[model samples]
Target chain A: MTSFFIYKAILVVVVFGIMLMAAMYSTYLERKVAAFIQDRVGPNRAGPFGILQPLADGIKMFMKEEIIPEVANKTLFIVGPCIAMLTAIMAGVVIPWGGELVINGVPYVLQIIDFDFGLLYVFGVVSLGVYGIMIGGWASNNKFSLFGAIRASAQMISYEIAMGLSIIALIMMTGTLSLREIVEFQAGGTGSTWNFWNVVYQPLGFLLFLVCAFAECNRTPFDLPESETELVGGYHTEYSSMKLGFYLFAEYINMFISSAVISTLYFGGTNFPFMNDLGLSQNAITILGTLAFFIKIGFFVFFYMWIRWTLPRFRYDQLMYLGWRVLIPLAIANVAITGLVMILTDRI
Target chain B: MKSLTGRAKVLDNPKMTFKERIYLPAIIGGITITLRHLFKRKATIRYPEEKRTFSPVWRGMHVLKRDDNGAERCTACGLCAVACPAEAITMTAAERKPGEEKLYREEKYAATYEINMLRCIFCGLCEEACPKEAIFLTDRLVSTDYARDGFIYGKDKLVEPVDKRVDVSKRQTPNVLEFKKIKHYRHNR
Candidate 1:
């Protein structure tokens, strides 16, 4: 039990470190991707190919003068970013990094927790993410901040419904709420056993979930909350120094977590095709699987940036229309179709 | 109204079709376009490390010229000062002593010549007005400075060094060279 506790503690630290590092680098990658799409070179001066740009940006953020509005609620202003960073990190707890690792005849799980309601835990944490923006925006005592916060809350709420409904279809197919079991269900490669990824079973659900994920992350085309053109920095308008940094960092971390969840839920988390046919050792397979999982997450993160640069932000009315009318109905139809197909095939 | 250039596009407000409304195909097309650009050659020159080459006839910073014996060619005739539309040029004339013949090509020389670079429009009027081919605009850019005084370029900043010469051969067109050979021009004679 003591060893198990030690293992869990170490895994927690490692995972937390990876999440922070991934978020840090994502900012650099975002600029690079944007520059490339526009036929420009970006930030190659800081370090070779601007690899150290994130560190410089972090230092600059920290060195900036801290400011609090005279009319602002100081306590909530401080708690806002704290909550954002906290909830953003919290969602990563349920993500299954890879399969189990056996060290010295003792098997250790790569996940922080394998709770039966792992999917629900992620959903719950993500829903709570809005409170951070809301509290911060409201406390600022600025109209723009309030507007951003309201939009964020409404967007998250609207998308969460469709996001949840889309997942219901996947959950029905897998018959498991635990992410680990969901991954395990799709274990074998495309061979004799033929356990395909969940995407093959829930293509429309995956698409709906993807759209919802973009909205939930407040990414572009769905990024009306912090629309710089309209809101003037939006929820973090009143924030300065590391406080503002925390808000931006939280967004990137949320992006990283969203990408992870998308990969785990639909793209077969750590499962790779022809994985079993390789006849690799359990430890080797686990390490390679972990690597494979990270690569998939990386691709999704890049995809997010690609879409961000390609599409313009949706109008507030357009956003609501798409979320409530288009996505919700599509997600419901997907769930119904999935149920009917499962019943006919006797998958239930 | 009829289009002047005959290239005007007609405006329309047709409702979106099912395919357009879905937006998946358009999104994919945009993604493909950006992907192609990602692999295309970057348009950036990465300035400081790389600079674009200027045209040979590009008029930039002014340089005071010298004769073959390295004597100052200007006789302080003041034609350039008169020709400068921006009133950027100023000079003081001084009589060249007998022993100073090696330094000054003419009996009279510009003792204190100055050009206010901030006021000069780089119109190459000074080059056009210099009868003795004493001043020409070179292909070197005037660097930025912090002080207003720094832009008042004196002889120390403008004059070509004895060891090295400013080449203005490109600016001397065939017509100017042919006119110089006419021998009737007092400076040419």
Candidate 2:
């Protein structure tokens, strides 16, 4: 058990390193996408096709002068992004990359650990994620920053309820809270019994889930917190250098993990059709599963960037109204329909 | 007045039906419309890799002019300075030196002329006011600097080199405010 913990710890470190690189590149991708949309030249220097742009940015950020506000809460300001980044990284542990691998006659799950309440675990981590933005904004002592933090806290907390409800509806259908069991439920080896993926059963639930995911993740149309026009850098207004970098990096990490969750939950979670009968080797099958999972996640990540450049952000009141009056009620109704259908079909 | 105290402030409300109350249909519809745009070969010029034609009319960095003989056309006539609305122009008239006839067309040529570009509004009134056709606004626009001092253009900065030429025939700059529709302001009487 101790050895397994060590391995999981190492895996966490490795995943975090990769996530760091990914978050930096997301910034690059964001800039490139923005430039292309607006018909302007983005960063194309520093390295070949600006592939080294992230590295340059990392170095620059590290070298930058740290600016602190005179009247701000010093310790909390520093801790805010740390909390955000930690929460973002923690969410990934519950997401099973592939079911498990048997090595040297020992079985080990692809996830860090098989938590029984993986869905709840994801929700719990995501809920805590808002505190980073809240503390950052409040600690900055700027009114604009405070306003942004308030928006973030309200927006995230509101959407999270709808998000949780949508997950509950999924749990009702899948009948499993564990990510591994959810993956297995979709895998068609149960005698041609898997009629369709969970999506077919819960299209409305999936839609609600994904939209709420976007709001919880706080992408555009929901990005009222960091609305550049109004907030002037938002929660990170008084932060500079590596502290600011942490806040920005936390956002992309959240985007990445949410994309992974959306992929795992809706799009069959590493389960592919007819790959088993194709007579492929076990290692090959595992690799294939990993590839499919990444393809789904990568597409969503790209979509997230694509939408940011395309849409204007929602107003604060409008966002609140949408969450409270629209999404929450819609989610409750979806739960009702899901429950009613399950009962009438005698599947309950 | 005593009876009116029982009444509360009224608020306007819109009635929503079953479908509207259950807004998944509309929200899904909104997502679908956006998804079409999300995939529609994004309407953008991937710039640097793909340079969009910045209209030849685009006002960018300005360049001064040299006459065809490479001699300055100004005869030290200070009409441009006087006509400038922004008070940008400044010059010192120097007497024509012997054997420098080909260099300057006038006996009284400007020895030192400087435009505090920070003050120059790029209005082209100075260009219109130049009787000698020396001071003119080029197709180029004003360049920018972080410091206030960088905006001041001396005679050395404003005068074009001998190799370069500005077409004497082409019209000077046009008024930007006049062309901008809807955002234009009308003088209140």
Tens digits of per-residue lDDT, candidate 1, A5-24, equal 89999999999999999999
Name the runs in model 2 displaced over 4 angstroms.
Answer: A1-10, A32-53, A64-77, A99-109, A130-160, A188-195, A219-238, A305-333, A343-348, B1-73, B77-98, B105-108, B115-137, B140-189
Candidate 1 residue A253 C-alpha distance from true site, Å: 0.4
The best candidate in terms of DockQ: 1
Worst 10 residues of 2 chain A by lDDT: A188-197
DockQ of each: 0.84, 0.08
Could you tell me the lDDT of residue A235 within candidate 2? 73
TM-scores for all predictions? 0.96, 0.74
Task: Tell me which residue pairs clash in candidate 1.
Answer: none
Model 2 chain B scores worst on lDDT over the 10 consecutive residues at B180-189
Give the Å error, residue A226, model 2. 5.3
Docking class of 1: high
Candidate 1: regions farther than 4 A off: A190-192, B1-11, B179-189
A87-165, model 2: which lDDT tens digit per residue? 9988988887875566676666667767899988988998999999999999999998998899889889889888888
